[model samples]
Target: MPAPKKPASKKASVRKSTKPQPDQKVLIAKDSLSHSEHFKTFLGWVQDKMNENLIHLQTPQVIESTNRHFMVSGKIEAYDEIWDEWAKFVDN
Candidate 1:
C-alpha cells in the first residue's frame, strides 16, 4: 500500500505580505495667471509646500495651460493631517 501524505504545516498556510501599501490620494490644483513666469513660480512653490508637509508625492507636478488658465495635478500618499493642510493650501 502507498504511504499516506503528510498534512501541510500551519506556517505554510500563513501568507506574508512583502511590502505594506500606503493609503493614497489624488491632488489637483488650478490657477488663472496672465504671466507664464508666475505660473512656473507658483508650481515650484506648491511643490515645496507639499514636500514640507511630508507628503509622499507619487508623480511630478503636471502643469497645463490654455489662454490664461493653468491646471496642475499630482498623486500622493494620504495622511489625514497632511492632506487637510494640502487642501487648505490649494484652496488659498
Candidate 2:
C-alpha cells in the first residue's frame, strides 16, 4: 500500500457573509466592559458569537450549502476545494 497524496492547491467555492474583525470586536468589547461583571458578560457574548459564526470541521451543513451553490455554477463539485474559500470568507 502507498500513502495518499495531498492536494496540490485549494479552490474557492462557497463563502460566508459573517466574518468578525478581531481588533474591532475586541475594541468594542473593551469599551463596553467598565467592570468585572460587565467584562464577564462581554466575554460570554463574544464566545457565543464565535460559536454561532465559526464553522466546525466536523459539521456537514456548511459544506452541503457550499456544494449546492457551487453546483448552480456547474463548477467545484468536491468538498475539499471549498475549505480555503470558507476560510477566506470567514477571515473577511
Per-candidate total of colliding backbone pairs: 0, 0
Query: What lDDT does candidate 1 reach at residue 6?
Result: 97
The residue-by-residue lDDT of candidate 2 on 1-92, one tens digit each, is 99999978978789876986679876565454434565455445545544444444225664568764444333322333343333332312
TM-score of 2: 0.27
**lDDT on C-alpha atoms for all candidate structures:** 0.44, 0.48
Q: Runs in model 1 with CA error above 4 Å?
A: 1-35, 55-92
Relative to the true structure, candidate 1 has a C-alpha RMSD (angstroms) of: 16.4
State the lDDT of candidate 1 residue by residue for 1-92, as single tens digits. Answer: 99999997776577889896543432223333323466556656655665744432332342123321222122223333444554443433
